[model samples]
Target: MSSNQAFESAKQEYEQWGINIDEVFKTLKNIPISIHCWQGDDVGGFEVNRGELSGGIDVTGDYPGKARTPEELRADIEKALSLIPGKHRINLHAIYAETDGQVVERDKLEPKHFEKWVTWAKEHRLGLDFNPTLFSHEKAADGLTLAHPDPEIRQYWIDHCKASRKIGEYFGRELGTPCLTNIWIPDGYKDTPSDRLTPRRRLMEALDEIFAEEIDKNYLVDAVESKLFGIGSEAYVVGSHEFYLSYALKNDVNCLLDTGHYHPTEMVSNKISAMLLFFDQLALHVSRPVRWDSDHVVTFDDELKEIAMEIVRNDALDKVMIGLDFFDASINRVAAWTIGTRNMIKALLFALLLPHCQLKELQENGDFTRRLALLEEFKTYPFGVIWNQYCQEMNVPAKESWLQDVQKYEEQVLSKRS
Candidate 1:
């Protein structure tokens, strides 16, 4: 059957469950997923004096055609954005700053360093987000940044974060969209540490210093991310979930939840509702974890669906700031971005199409049997047909047809990168 005919049939099926598919489309188009820029270059930013990847983060595989420059990275991102449906934002790190071959320290970074990025974002009508790079620097060589015991080192990172927030505010002011500036540091000991409280205390003080200057919330939003454990920090991490949860709540800042930053059994989906109860808003770093906090590309798994459902059902779509955060250098870099981001949008679409109110009613009325049956039965619903329709309406290729574009781009553009 033709795609339109298939969609018509699927639309009728969903309509029977009282789902307004038209409304779902309208809502879905407004939800923008912040696509991370690092995926195009495997977290290797364009720093003149670039150092090796450090601070428990690693991007493996020697994938050819990885973006080596800021221009190339932006082009690759453009290609991926063309394939993905809907308008989205680009998330950038401090290391991606362009200093014209001059070695600019992180603390000294200014808005002019990202003029090209702001121009590109304006040209494409895209929003921009920022992150303070707290890893892969000589200062963070020991896997400690803000939490470093040395007063001078902590002050340096604190200054870097303060500078990053200004750049974020610049993007927001120029683009007319509030920028989300997130801070994630890899400061933890490989083994157990006797003085855990001291490092956390130092981190708290550093953060206070970084956020001491009051920037208008209309321009820039601040966030802090927490990690359970990482490559080097197996025993203890200074920015534990509990630490940031309390900090974010007390300080009126957003706490970012990375899907891969928790234990294997602890799901981020389960934490969404609880977080919304206290905070006015929260943020997410959607990623997949394989065994450990391995930054694998996001997949449309149960957890992803549940996460989307939590956002949609709780009516917290505006309250939750969603962004992609994964770097996989094993496959085509552009394809990695396309696949992960498409899956994230797909999960949201799936959540939007569900009869959330009816399901809640069933559960509240103690109709567990019917609820379970209906949930399983809906799994076989014509979700793909609706997704294909979304892609078609968004003027992007539907289904696996987008892969052909990626392949063609690979041959024409990416393969010639080196």
Candidate 2:
């Protein structure tokens, strides 16, 4: 059925259930959402809380599973947003050159490219999940093997960020699309090959310099990514919820929580509580199987779903932004994204109604069983059929057009049985 039809169907469910259909619809009708992402092919348009955002810039917008010429990326964004209109935020992961501070100047993409991207995105109604300085990281367990992590990498990142910020500064002046930047140390290492303390200091010092550099802009910076590991036995700084809050408060950076990136114990709702109590800075990330090495899929389960609903209820929704963070090149990328998003929405709607009672308890007692249940709750997910019923019952548009689409996606994710 079409969106209008689905909306009508949802209205029926609202009435039948003896619940305020309009009230429920109004609550989630067009929620405040953002996505922490992996590589994506659809690019160039804007979708924010307000309306559709048009795409800008051409050539060189590639995330691992996605590679497009800047112009192609520009056009793709326009195409992608047509399917789901309105305000949508997209996270640009570590797409910068790190360690090589000055080498980034050689790229063909000009500041005009960055400026155009930001301007058109803002005018079109999309916010940027921009990491002023981000780079891909691979590990050897013994050391960190980042894309670029030496003097060359440092110079490249420095130039890229400066150039990128020049674009940020330009568009931020007129459109002011509210840019959220999360900078991670894609290459910080332990002190002299064995000293654990060195990595933290070096990484912190590096980011502090970057923040100090970009401090002029009205940007909120998150220091970590979901489970993004570091070189030689150390993970990223914002490992513990408290760690991020402490770092953000001590150094003055915003905590961008990637729920899927946390260790098993840190549930979503509680993570936000820390953000609220400590820094008051909030950011959004969505993924299923909360304990995966690589982001398996952009789906969610019940417990995870409930927490997402709480995220919306927290009224801190505005302080937060949401986005999709998964990719697959072997298959149709757009289809993959649609299903992933559909699963998230399905899980989210269910979570809205239920209570994460144990979540709060676990936060207080550190009980093992609650932790197990929380993990178990989201295991059999991407409940595509259940999600479809939800959208139908709620009078909401179905993000995923078909059940086959849902099944195909469910089969792809290996359950990390919480």
Candidate 3:
């Protein structure tokens, strides 16, 4: 067929799939919604509509952010948790850009920061997903270096993974953090579709080494992450559920779902959510995504929220942890957390509101749009409207730097009027 004919055919197929969003709204009237915590970015171009409601928040800390001062930060976090309805934790996809040391050397700061952070998680009952960027220099590489080629690196991972297991075992004991031992390499191509199979194979080898040893001794830290690109075109990481699972080994492996990593064409359906059940461990990622960009915000709309929560609610999945992958400028902290958490609750509330029979059939049959209008209707409903309300209600301070944005906008408006 001609290109125009192909386009028409595809449109026709999509038209059938498209449901009446209005009708979905009709179904979503006044459903209650809440999220444990979220990283919203309303200050940035990404508007997180949700922070109006019930839930705690997990946004970034400042200048060296809270991670730099784990103790004071942890105490602050624990206080916030106590104040809010629920407080969920988040692991930054990348640690600070300045981390060139192996560990954030306990003695590096005027007062050691690492020990305090360890103390905080231990005291507060917060679970963690440790993600160290491979970009950090040798001392800070967390023992495994991504600088090597696949063949050489595979062995390095094998060796390094042993140390990771030991460290994880210690952390688990010290902090009593349940999940431990996870790793993801940012070693994918920039320009050409470089060593596609090599990195994946090395990743597999590293995991196998960790699993064979770690699983029996203590709970193996679940390896969970998806594919994404930073600079160039080749996004070779595990970008989708189908592809993520395709390479997944049969033993001790778990599924990790990242929201922003997917190609625009990917869809998260009930059936897709069902696949997560196969893993011994599963975790859902929260990140804001637009057409081509992953902004990492909190408030996502109907379709985006639905597919995400369906995976979360699947009873079959074990150790179902939900965490945020927020990537906004450092200044918009409260808004980011508020909006992100609010959207998260909306997702959970969406699941709570659904009729068991209908939801089940929808999951079994993959009838996605059936929930679309209802989901949208949530924005108008008390729950959705309340997310923003809750954010406003919270005494949480806004980012100091972002306050300047208000003055600038006001000045521009006054000038225009004059």
Candidate 4:
């Protein structure tokens, strides 16, 4: 049968359970996943002539045709978005500013530095998100920023973060969407630290100063991200999950949870409900981490499914901002974006297809055996048929058909790049 015919069959089957497939498709198409810009360039932004990636972050492989300029990066993003179904947003770091052959210090960056990006996003009808590039700078080379003991160094980063907020506000105002400005500083010690409290205190004080200027909530929403540990800072990271969670609650800002930032055993899915209870909204950086914070390309794995299920089951789609954060230089950068994003969209569709209410009622009523049976049964449902239908409705290629387009682009466009 044809794709639509198959989907209709699946729709009829799901309707037997009182599930509205049409409504689920509508909801999934409306959800916007913010695609990170760094993935296009392998986390290498066009800030300086030539600079190596630092600050506890690194991208493996030397994939040819990696975007080397802001224009090239935007082109890759445009191509990726065309293949992915649904309205989407772009996540940009401050480092991607289109400076006209001048070394503008991070502390001195302004909204004008990103005028091109704002214009492009507007033209594409896409929303924008911003992040302060706290690492890969001389000041941050010491493995500390925003919490550095030196008054001068700490002040520099504070100013940069403040500027990022202003830039974020500008994007939101221009695009008619609230921009999320996330702060993730790589401040930690390689080995055991003599004093941990001092750094944490300094960080708290610096955050207070950065957020001293209050902007209207309509344009910008602030967030802070935490990491358990980084490559060099294996001992301790200043912005641990507990610190950000408490800070987010007390400061009335969102706490961004990167799927790869937590321990191996701990699942971000379990933490979503807890965060939702205390905070009005939550932010997510969805990526796959094999071990530690090794940001592998995202796949439709168990955690990804659980995370999506939590959001759907809680009815918190509006309360959460989903974004992709991964750099896989080993593969085609544009394809990487499409693959990861499509996987995320697929996972959400899978979650929406579940009999959440039925399963919950069983668990709540203590019908353990029935709950397990229902849970297992959901695995065999015709979710793929519905997902194919989603792609068809979105007018994007269904299944792995999008990969051929990426390959064509690679041959026609990417391979031509030096």
Best prediction by lDDT: 1
Clashing pairs in 1: none
Cα lDDT, all candidates: 0.95, 0.47, 0.43, 0.92
Better of 2 and 4 by TM-score: 4
Candidate 4 Cα misplacement greater than 4 A, ranges: none
Q: Would you list the clashing residue pairs of candidate 4?
A: none
The order by descending lDDT is: 1, 4, 2, 3
lDDT value, candidate 1, whole model: 0.95
* Candidate numbers, best TM-score first, in rank order: 1, 4, 2, 3
Tens-digit lDDT string for candidate 4 (100-135): 989999999999999999889989999999999998
Worst 10 residues of 1 by lDDT: 55-64
Cα lDDT tens digits, model 1, 220-329, are 99999999999999999999999999999989999999999999999999999999999999999999999988889999999999999999999999999999999999
Q: How close is candidate 1 to the true structure, as a TM-score?
A: 0.99
Residue 273 of model 3, lDDT score: 51
Off-target runs (Cα >4 Å) in candidate 1 are none
Runs of candidate 2 exceeding 4 Å displacement: 1-19, 29-32, 35-38, 41-67, 93-111, 119-123, 136-166, 188-193, 214-243, 264-266, 289-291, 351-418
lDDT of 3 by residue, 199-286 (tens): 4555665556556663433533665455555433344442324445664546545566666656666654443555654655555565
Candidate 2 global CA lDDT score: 0.47
Number of residue pairs clashing in candidate 3, backbone atoms closer than 3 angstroms, sequence gap of 3 or more or interchain: 28
